[model samples]
Target: MAFSAEDAKTASAVWEKIYADVEDNGAIVLSRMFKENPHTVSYFKNFTQLQSIPETASAEEIAALAEVRGHGKKVFSALNDLVSHLTNVDSLKATIVPLAKKHATELKVDVKDFGIIFENLLHLIGQKQGGDAKEAFEKVTNLIYEEIKAAY
Candidate 1:
């Protein structure tokens, strides 16, 4: 979520595109974008690995992720924290937008498709947890998406 102004603009705009596609074509289309794009797949795979405990993650892994969880909470405290950092155009530009472009190229998909896959993967993670973890994860995830959606 270390976005710069341009990254924010790109991410925000791309999110709008993804939402529009979802609104117009639905989740299946979004899923198709992931299936069709390899860059999107790589982006998603990287993001998932970064954010979640791995499939074979041990208790130590869980503990490490727990620390990240606290860091995630701080980001959750402010909605704009999701992309507001993008006000620093250099940082944002350095990261997300390029990734977006790379995602489009690597996956042979649109930036919007990459966005939808990112969003849905988060959704899927939320679905996998139960009770408090589910609730907390969904809340943070929904907040992040809502901000991305609002930027449109």
Candidate 2:
């Protein structure tokens, strides 16, 4: 999975919208993942806390929700950083190598889980930005996942 010139151009443009939406949309993306694959949250330390809360509970009511929201910001930022370096393998590796190590060793996030991330991300991108934007997003997502999986 190489990043072609066209993919870089497309991703560079689409990333702006993604960056803008992340603050509000990141949690939604993560929430969708949690809703779809509840067991996946086991990778996180607060898994039980997040699961115990009622779905309708407010952020203030459930501390785990707030913590997850914070995690969403970090995820979005890392995604943005990775996409920003799509044109250069060295730069991309620089970003992914440490993240891959951390995720695999410390977080214990399996490489296969990235597929779920990709699917949910695709859904989120389609709902917010369709057409070429979705295509670009897919390329970016695949690159990030593939590179990270390789390292992990």
Candidate 3:
């Protein structure tokens, strides 16, 4: 689904708020994704131990969590780039296609995993920012997922 100009504007404004603390928020989204769908962890070799980490984590677990946070930052940064270009479909598609190809080919990420990420991200936005932000982001995320699926 294509986002209207107003949808893009609203999503961009909300994204600015989230991106201010992208590292922490992104980590929360990824952590929530793993928790909600344990099967998805198999795709991340480095984070395979994520599910096994205890509340009182060991130093190793701490390092793993830190890595997850770092990866989360990268994930959100990519999203930020896409959201910033929402008003220009050509620019957005150019930016997303390469990353989608990398995930599909290099990472061998299952297409279904994108849906998991989309749902988790929406949940995070709804929980932290409220329904309006979630609604705005939903369109952007749907586009992202659709583009990725097509690329795959």
Candidate 4:
């Protein structure tokens, strides 16, 4: 289903707050992602650099976390653009097509991987803004997943 203009507005506003939090805590998100699916990290050439730190992280671990955070910023920057243009179907298609192609072909990302990421993302959003925001995310992310799956 196409997202309504109201949905787009809600999503755009929610994303600004969520993206800010995500940009700051991207490493935690990545850490959770890696913990749940270690194989996902293999897609990154720098996966080996990640430190297995818990209570007390060393300098190397800190650096690795920074790297993960940097990657998060890049990902969310794209997300910011996509969300910002949710009301524009042409713009959305332009962004998702190339991104989906890279993900499907170069990264060989499975559809299931998108589900996992979205699940965690929604959970994070739920923590921040409760049900309405998640409902908006649910609609938008499903649309994104469908678009990506089509390209795949």
Candidate 5:
């Protein structure tokens, strides 16, 4: 479905708040994803050893968190790119398609995992920003998912 101007405005406003603390918010979303869906960790090599680590403030644990935070920043940066182009579907698709292909081919990420991440992100938005932000993002997420699915 096409993203309406109003929806874009609403999503952009909510996204601006999230992007203000993109690294932390992205890490929170990704950390939740790993915690809730342990199977997803298989796709992340750096995170594999983390599963074996005990729940203590060890070097490995700290390093893993730092890796997660760094990766989270990249994820949010890509998201910011997409969100900024919401008003232009051509630009959005152009941006997403290559990333989608890379995930499918290079990263070998299961397309379904994208949906899971979106669920976690939506939940975070709902928890922190409330229903309206969540609702707006739901539409944007669906559009993104569709594009990724098509690429896959």
Candidate 6:
């Protein structure tokens, strides 16, 4: 199933809540949410604080998390193509990069932001959870796209 605007809103709201919580406390709300709702843990990445102790996550940790998520997406997409076809699989990057390139002039944000967010989402799901979760992430991306459309 494709993602809806409401789905993006929900995801963004979740993200904002998690981010704000991380800013205010040392804990990640998403991680805690998973512990509280173990059944739904599949929806978010599990991050542990292993470095210097602080009341909240450091900016470096946040940046590293984002990088991990982006890298995870690239790996997940490659794996998906490999599993789907040994010789004639479609390239997710090729498909998505051109779309960003084509619409670079019209997007409200930088074209790279679209790719970065998409990649980050994928990375978070694939590496933190499992590669099988890419479909779910794709649905969320589709929902974000729909929401973006409605906005402008």
Give the number of the best model, judged by lDDT.
Answer: 5
lDDT of 2 at 33: 69
Candidate with the larger lDDT of 5 and 6: 5
Q: In every candidate, how many clashes are there? A: 7, 0, 0, 0, 0, 2
Better of 3 and 4 by TM-score: 3
Weakest 10 consecutive residues of candidate 2 by summed lDDT: 54-63
Please give the distance, in angstroms, between residue 18's alpha carbon in candidate 4 and its true position after superposition: 0.8
What does candidate 3's lDDT look like per residue over 56-150, in tens digits?
45433433487678988999999988998888888888998999999889988888888887787888788889998998888888888888888
lDDT for 121 in candidate 3 is: 83
- Top candidate on TM-score is 5
After superposition of all CA atoms, the RMSD between model 1 and the true structure is 13.4
Q: Which structure is stronger by TM-score: 1 or 2?
A: 2
- lDDT agreement with native, every candidate: 0.40, 0.75, 0.80, 0.71, 0.83, 0.39
Off by over 4 Å in 6: 1-108
Q: Write the per-residue lDDT of candidate 5 for residues 56-133, one digit (tens) a residue.
A: 334334334876788878988999999988989899999999999999999999999999989988998999899989
Q: Where is model 5 more than 4 Å wrong at Cα? A: 48-51, 54-64
For candidate 4, lDDT tens digit of each residue in 1-152? 55688888888877878887765545555556666776666667654356444325442354357677787677667777778767777778888899988988888877678777777677778888998888878888887778778767
TM-score of each: 0.29, 0.85, 0.87, 0.84, 0.89, 0.32
- The TM-score of candidate 5 is 0.89
Residue runs of model 1 more than 4 Å from their true location after superposition: 1-90, 105-107, 130-152
lDDT of 5: 0.83
User: How close is each model in CA RMSD to the real structure?
Assistant: 13.4, 3.1, 3.3, 3.4, 3.1, 15.2
Model 2: CA > 4 A from native: 47-49, 54-64
Estimate, for each residue in 91-120, the C-alpha lDDT of model 6 and write its tens digit: 333343444444444433443344444554
- Best first by TM-score, ranked: 5, 3, 2, 4, 6, 1
